[model samples]
Target chain A: MAQITFEDLSLSFRVRKGGKIGWKDFIVQGLRGKGQDDDWLTVNPLRNINLSITRGERVGILGNNGAGKSTMLKVLAGIYPPTVGKRTIEGTISSLFDLSLGFEYDATGWENIRYRGFLQGETPKSIEAKIDDIAEFTELGEFLDMPLRYYSAGMVVRLGFAIATSAMPEIFIVDEVLSAGDAAFQEKAKKRMNKMMDTASLVVLVSHDMSLLGEFCTRVLWMDKGRIKEDGPAKKVIAQYLEESRQQQAA
Target chain B: MTKAIAATSDYFTQIWQMRYFWLSLVIKDLRTRYRGSVIGMGWSLLHPIAMTAVFCLVYTTLFDVSLIEYAPFVLSGMTLWGFFMTVTHEASQTFLISQAYLRQNPAPLAIYPLRTTLCGSFHFLLAMLVLFVYTWVVQGFGNLTAFGYLLSSLVLLFVIGWSMACCCGILNVLFQDTQHLLQVFMQMMFYCSPVFYYPEMVEKRGMGWLVDINPFAACMELIRAPVLRSEAPEIQSVLFAGGFALVLLCTATCLLARYQRRLIFHL
Candidate 1:
C-alpha cells in the first residue's frame, strides 16, 4: 500500500492589485482591490501535484526557489490542505521543515531536546533516558547546559536536528534542514538519516542539493513552476532537471 | 467530513504531545523576563506593589477614595487589578512575541499564547503569595471565609486568561498591529475599569452603565469582592465571561486550523 498519496493537489495565493476601489466592492473583491480597474489576480503556488509513494521509498524533491518544493512537503505533512485535490496519508508523521521552530532559545539545549521529544509524543522517562544520547549526538558538550540563545547558529541547527531525529517516525519529512550544519555535524546527520531510512516507511526530502539527492534518494521528483517536470530514477531525472535549468538560464 | 474528523482528533493529539513543550516555554519565558535583575522573580510582586503605592498616593491623597479605605482595601483591589492587566497585556502579545517558535516548529499555535497566559498566571500565583504575607501581617491571617472567594476568583481569572490568550493569540497573528493597539487599549481600560476606584464610586458618578459594558471591570470586581467583601462574583457576570471565553476558544480553533498554514507566509 502506498504510504502517502497526493492527488491533483493545487493551491493558489492571491496577488493583490494596487490602489483602492468602491467601498462595498473593495471588501467583496476577495483577494485584491475592487472596481478601480486594477481588479485582482491569483497565482498558483502548487498546481496539480499528484504523487504516490509506497513504504520505504526515499524520494527527493528538487526545484529552484518558488518551484513549490516546500509547499508540497507541507501538503504531505498535512500542514496545508490542498485547494483542489485530496491527500491520503497513512501512519504517524514527523516533519523537520524549519529547524528552529519548536526550541526555546532561553532554555538549555538539554531542556529543548526534552521538550521537542515530548512534542513528538515521547514519554518523559523515555526522553530522560535518551537525553544523554541526544546530547552526545549533537556534540554540544557542556554548552548544552547554557541557554540556546548563547549558542551559535550552527549549534542551534545541530541541536534542532538532533532533537527532531530522535524519534523514529513512520513517515519522515526533511525540508532543507541538512544544509545548515558544519561538515562534521552534517556527516553525523547524514548517518542518522541513513539509519532512519532503513526503518522509515516513507522518507521525503526537499532540497536543492542535486548531488546529495543523487547520492541518497532512490527516486527524484523535479518540480518546475509548481508542476512536476519529471519523475524517475534519481540520476536520470536529476540530469534532465539540470539540463532544463541550463536551457532556461540560457534563454 | 471524515478528513475533518481525523484532523480534529489529530489536533487534540498534537496538543497533548506538545504539552511539555508549552510547559518548558512558560518556564523559559518567566526566567528570561527577570533574568538579569538583582531581585529576579521578586520583580513580579514588586511591580504590583509599586503600582499600588503610586496609585494609592495619587488616588487616596489626591482623591478621597484612597482615604475611605486604608492599605487593606487598596492592596486587595490593586492586587487583583494588577493580575488582570498583567495577564491580558502579556497574553495579547504572546503570539507576536513568540513568532520564532510559531514559525519554526509544527507545534500548535495555541500553545504560544497558552505559555504566556500560564506564565502570567504563575506570576500571579507568586504575587498572591506575597499578597497573603502582607495581608497576614496587617490583618492577622483570620480570613478563612475569604479564602473560598479568593480561590474561586483565582480560578475565574485563570479561565479568563486562557480565553483571552486564545483570542488575542490569533488576532496578533492576523493583525500585526494588535499588540500595540492592545497595549494602548489596556491602558485606557485601566482607568475606565474602576481598579483604583471602587465600583460604587463609578455607580455614584452615574457611570454605572460603563461598568455594565466593561468586562475587565466585572472581572476585577469578581476578584476583589471575594477577597475584600467576602461575596461571590455575580453568577450572571461569571456566565457572561464563560460564554465569551467559549466563543473565543471556538474562534481561535477555527482561525488556527484554517490559517495556521498561512501564518508563516504572513510572517
Candidate 2:
C-alpha cells in the first residue's frame, strides 16, 4: 500500500528578524559572536496537523496566500522535513510544482527534457523512450534544437508540461503548473492531467481554482494560518471556504 | 547518537540510489562548459597548455632554469593546481546554483559537490594526459614505480579538492562570505604551495617543514617525483597525504550529515 501518513507534523523556518537580510551584515554579526543581536524569527508554516492519504486518493489543498497549502504539498513531496513530528511515506514521488524545476537555460529544449526527466528520477532509457512523444506534444519542432535561453515564456511552459506528463508517476504532486500555457494548451493540459490523475495511485494537488478542485478531487483540505480549517468532500469544503472568504472580504 | 548514525546511513543510501542523477549532471555540466566554443572538447587541454607556456617562459628563460628539467616539473604542478582552482571555484556556488532543482524535490545535498568534483576531475584527467604526453616527448618517460606513486598522488589530490569543496560549498550557502573567502584563500595557497617553484628550493632555505607539513606538497610530490624528478615519492609524504585526505573527507561527510535537512531552509 502506497500511503502518506503525518502525525502531528510541523515545520518552522528561521529568518533574520531585523529588517532586510544582507550577507555583509550577517558575517559581521557572526564574527562578533553577537548572535543575540541578530534577531531570529521562527515561522511555522505547518503546525500540529495529522493527516493520512492513501492510495487512489486525489486530495486538493485550498488556501489563501501564505496559508501553508504549498508548504503542506512540499512536505508531502519530501522537500521539507517535519520539525516536530513524524511523516512516513511509501511510494515513488514526482513533483510538478515548478515549471522549470531542473531546466538549464544554456541547454537546448531537447536537453532540458532529459534534465527535467532525470530530476524526476526517471532513467535515461525511460526518458529517451518518451522523448519523441514529448517533442511532438510540445509542437517545438526545430526550436527544440535551440537553447532554452532563446525560448519564450510560453514555449518554456509547454516544454515543461510536455516532459512532466510524459511518465506515469506513483505519487504525483502539482501546484499551479496546470495553468502554465495559454488557453488552448490549458485545455489540452487539463485533459492530460485528468489522464495522469486517473492513472496515478496518489495525487496531492494544491490549487486556488475551486472549480478545478471540485472536478478533480473527491476530498479537499482548506487551510488557514498553518492549520486545516476544513476537511471534507471537495464541493462542501469549497463552499464553506468561499463563504468565509466572501464574509472576510465583505467585512 | 543513534539518530545521527541512522541519518548518515540513510544519506548514503539515498545517494547510492541516485548515482545516475549525479553522473548525468556531471556530464551535463561538462558539456555545457565547452558546448559552443570553437575548440569544443579541446578546451579542456587548453588550461594546462597555456599555463605551461607562461611558466616555461618565466622560470626557464628569465630565471635561467633548464628547459629539459624544469618544463616537466612546472607543467605537472600547474595541472594539479589548475584542478584545485577550478574545483574550489565551481564548488562554492554548487548549492546556490542548484537552488532550482533543490526546491523541486528533496535532492541529496552531496550531489551538488559531486557535480563540481566529477566535472573538475574529468577535465583534470584530460588536461593531465595532454601535459604528460607533451612532457614525455620532450623528456623521457619516468620509471614505472614512480607512475604508481603518481597515480596514488592524483587520487589524494582529487579527494583533497572534493573535501575542500564539500565544506566550503555548504558554508558558502549559509554565509555568502565563504565564496569571497575561498577566492582569497586559494590565491594565498597558490603562492604558499609549490605550484610555480620547486619544493627543494623552499627546503634549501631551511623551511623544509613547510613542504613536509603542507598537504599540497605531499600531493604535488606524486606528480613531480616520477614524472619530473624521476624518483619515488617519500613514504612519509604519501602517508601524510593519505591521512590528510581521510581527515578532510570525514569532516565533509560529517558536516553534510548533520546539516543536510537544515540546508533546504538555508537555501
Candidate 3:
C-alpha cells in the first residue's frame, strides 16, 4: 500500500551572500578566523510538519505565494530531504512539476517521448506499446517529426502533458501544471487528469484554483507561512481559506 | 558489513535500472555534438591528429628520432590525454547541464558522470582504433599477448575517468571556481607529464622522482608498454595506476554519499 508519513519534519536552506564563494574569499575567510556558518543566512521553508497521508486520498493544498505549498509537494515527491526530521514513503512516486523543463531541444518529439518514457521507468517495449496512444493524445500529427526547438510554447506543453500523464502513477504529485496550453487543451487536460486521478492510488496536488480543488479533492490542507493552518474536508477548508483571504483583502 | 554491501548493491541496482535513461542521454549528446556537420565524429579525431602531426614535425627533428615511430607514439599519448581532458572537463558541467532533470526526477546522481565518461570513452576508442591501424601500417601488429593487456588497461582507465568526473562534477557544483582551477591545474599537469616526450627523458633530466610519483606517468607507461614496445605493462606501473584508481574511486564514493542529498541546494 502507498503511504507517506512525515514526523516533525523541518527544512531550512543556508544561503550565502553570493550563490557561491570564490577561492580568494574562501582563503580570506579561513584566515580571518570567522566561522563559515556565520556568513550564511538560513531560510526555513518547512517547520514542524507532522502528518500522514494514506493511500486512495485525493488531497489538495491551498496556500498563498511563499506559504510553502510547492515546497511541501517537493518534500512529498522526495526531491528534498527534511533537514531535522524523518520522512518515510512507500510506493513509486511520479511527480509532475516543471513540465516543460527537461526536454532535449535538438531531439524530435517522437524521440523525446521515448526519453521521457525511460526517465519515468518504462522499458523500450512498454514505451513502444504506448507510443501511439501518447502521440494521438498530443494531436501534433506531422509536427511530432520536427525537433522540439521548432515547436511553439503551446505545442511543447501539449507534448509534455501527454507524455507525462501517459502512465498511471502509484503516488502522483502535481504542482500548478493544470492551467497550461490553450482553452481546448486545458479542457482535454482536465479530462485526462480526472481519468488518471480516478485510477491513481493517491494524489497530492497544489493549485490556486479553489473550484478545481473543490471538484477533485476529498480533503484540503490550508497552509500558512510553513505551517498547516487548517485541515478538513475539501468544502469546509477551502471555504474557510477563501473567507480569510477575503477578510485580508478588506483589511 | 553486510548492510553496507546491501546498500552498495542497492545503489548500483538503482543506477542499472536507469540505464536506458542515461544511455539515451549519452546518445543524444553524441548526436547533437556532430549534428549538421559534414566531417561528423572525425571532427573529434582531427584535433589529436593535427596536434600529433605538428608535434611529430617539431619533435622528430629536435630528438633526431624517426617519424614512423614517433607518429604513433605521440598519437597514442595524445589520445589518452584527450580522453582524460574531455571526461574531467565536461563532467564538471554534467550536474549543471542536467539540473532540469535532477529537479524533475530523483535518479542516481552518478549517472550524470557516467554519461560524460561514456562520451569521452567513445572518442578515446575511436582514436585508439586509428592508432592501431597506423601502427599496423608502420610496424605491423604488436605482441597479441600485449594487446590483450590493453583491454584491462582500458577498463581501469574507464573507472578512473568516471571517478575523476564524479569528483570534479561534485566539486564544480559546490565551488563555482572548480572548473577554472581544474583547467589551470591540468595545463600544468600536461607539461609535467610526458605527453609529448618519453618518461626516460624525465629520468635523464633528473626528474625521475616525478615519473615515480605521477599517476599520469604510470598511466602513460601502462598504455605505451602494450602498444609501442609490444610487451605487457610492468606490474609496478599497473599497481601504481590501480592504486590511484582505487583512491579516486573511494574519494568519489565518499563525496557522493555525503553530498547526494544536499547537492540540490548548492545547485
Candidate 4:
C-alpha cells in the first residue's frame, strides 16, 4: 500500500543580494572586510506543513502564487529535502511536474522515449514493453523516427503525456502538466488521468481548474501564504475558498 | 534508492538496480557528443593518435632521439594520459550537465561519476586499440606477451579516473568555480607528468624522485613500463596509485552520503 506523511515539514532557501555569489564573491567580501552576514535572506517556501496521505486517496492542492503548492509536491517527489522536519514516503513515486525535463532535443522521438524512460527510473525492459503503446497514443507516426527538434508543441505534449502516464505509479504527483497539449488530445489525456486516478493508490494533483479538481479529488487543501487555510471534503473546501477569494478580490 | 542506506550492502544493491540508468546515460553521452559532424565518432580515434604523432615528431627531433624508439614511448604514455586528462577535465560537468536527471530522479549519488567514467573509458579503450595497432606494425608482436600488464594498467587507470571524477564532481556541484580551477590544475598536471617525455631524462637531472612522488608520473609508468617495454611496473607505483584512489573514493563516498540530498539546494 502507498503511504506518505509529513511532520511539520519546512523548506527554506538562502538568497544572496547580488545573486548566486560564488567563491570570487566570498574572496572579495573577505578582502573588503565589509561582510557581516547582511546579504543573505532565508526564504521559506513551505511552513510547518503536516499531513498524512494513505492508499486510495486523491487530494488536490489549491493555492495562489508562491503559496507552496509546487513546493509541497516537490518535497514529496524527493526533489527538496525539508529543512527542519521529517518525511516518510512508502511506494514507487513518479513525478510529472516538468514532463520534458530529461528529453533530448537532438535525439529522435523514439530514442527520447528510451532516454525519458531511463530518467523516470524505468528499466529498459519495461520501457520496451510500453513503446508501442506510447507510439500509438502519441500518433506521431513518422515523427517518432525524426528528431524531437522537428516536433511541434502539440506533438511534444502528446509524447510527454503518453510517456509519463504509461507507467502505473503507486504515488503520482501532477503539477500543472495537464494544462498543456491541444484540445482534442487534452480531452484524451484527461480521460487517461481519470482512469489512473480511479485505480492508483495515492494521487496528489495541483491545479487551478476548480471543476477538474472537484471532479477528481476526494479531499482538498486550501493553502495561503505557505500554510493550509482549509482542509476537508473537496466540494466544501472549494466552495469556501472560492467565496473568500472572490470577496477579497472585490474588496 | 529510497531504501535504508545505513548498511554497506544496500549501497551496492541500489547502485546495481540503477545500472540501466547509468548505462543509458553513457550511451546518450556518446551519441550526442558528435551528432552533426562528418567525421563523427572517428574523432575519438583521431584525437590521441594525432596528438601522439605530432608530439612524437616534434619532441624526438628536438631531443635528437630516434623515431623508431620514441614512437612506442610516446604512444603508451599519451594513451594513459589521455584517460586521466579526459576524466579529470570532464568530471566537473558530470553533475552540472545532468542536473535534469538529478532533480527528476533520486538514484545513487555515485551515478554521475560512474557514468562519466564509463563514457571516458569507452574513449580510453578505443585509444588503447590505436596503441596496439601501432605497436604491432612498428615494434612487432614480441611485446604483446605483456598484454596482461596492459589489462592491469587499464583497471588501475579506471580506478584513478573514477576517484578523480567522484572527488571533483561533488566540489564542482557546490562551487561553480571549481571547474575553472580544475582546468588549470589539469594543464599543470599534463606538463608535469611523463606524457610527452621520458622519466629517465628527469632522473638524469637528479630529479629521479619526482617520478616516484608524482602519482600521475607513477600512473604513467604503470602503463608505459609494462606495455611499451614489457617490464613489470614498480610494485610501489601500483600500491601508491591504488592507495591514493582508495582514499579519494572513501572520502567521496562519505561526503556524497552526507550531502547527497542537499545537493539540489546548491544546484
lDDT tens digits by residue: candidate 4, B83-142: 776677788888888887777767777788999999888887777777777777877886
State which candidate, 2 or 3, has the greater TM-score. 3
Candidate 1: list runs displaced more than 4 Å.
A15-41, A149-153, A249-251, B1-14, B65-68, B234-265
In candidate 4 the C-alpha lDDT for residue B102 amounts to 76
The total of clashing pairs for model 4 equals 0
Candidate 2 off by > 4 Å: A18-38, B1-13, B61-63
> lDDT per residue, candidate 1, B1-267, as tens digits?
899889888877877777877776677777778989999988887867787787777877666653434455666656666666655666767766777565445567767767877877777777667666665665565555668867876776776777677777666655555666778888898778776777777799899988878877767666656555556778766776666666666776787787666765545
**Candidate 3: misplaced stretches above 4 Å?**
none
The candidate maximizing lDDT is 3
TM-score of each: 0.87, 0.92, 0.97, 0.93
Could you tally the backbone clashes for each prediction? Answer: 3, 0, 0, 0
Over B163-248, each residue of candidate 3 has an lDDT whose tens digit, in order, gives 99999999999888889998998888888888888788889989988888989988988888888878888899999999999999
- Where does model 3 sit among the CAPRI classes? medium
Q: Comparing to the true complex, what docking class would candidate 1 get?
A: acceptable
lDDT at B244 for candidate 4? 78
**Pairing residues by index, what is the TM-score of model 3?**
0.97
Candidates in order, interface RMSD in Å: 5.2, 2.5, 1.2, 1.9
CAPRI category for model 2: medium
lDDT over C-alpha atoms for residue B240 of model 3: 97
Model 3 RMSD to the real structure?
1.6
lDDT of 2 by residue, A19-114 (tens): 444467766777878565448888999999899988888899999999999889889888888999999998877777766566888888988888
Error of 3 at B101 (Å): 0.9
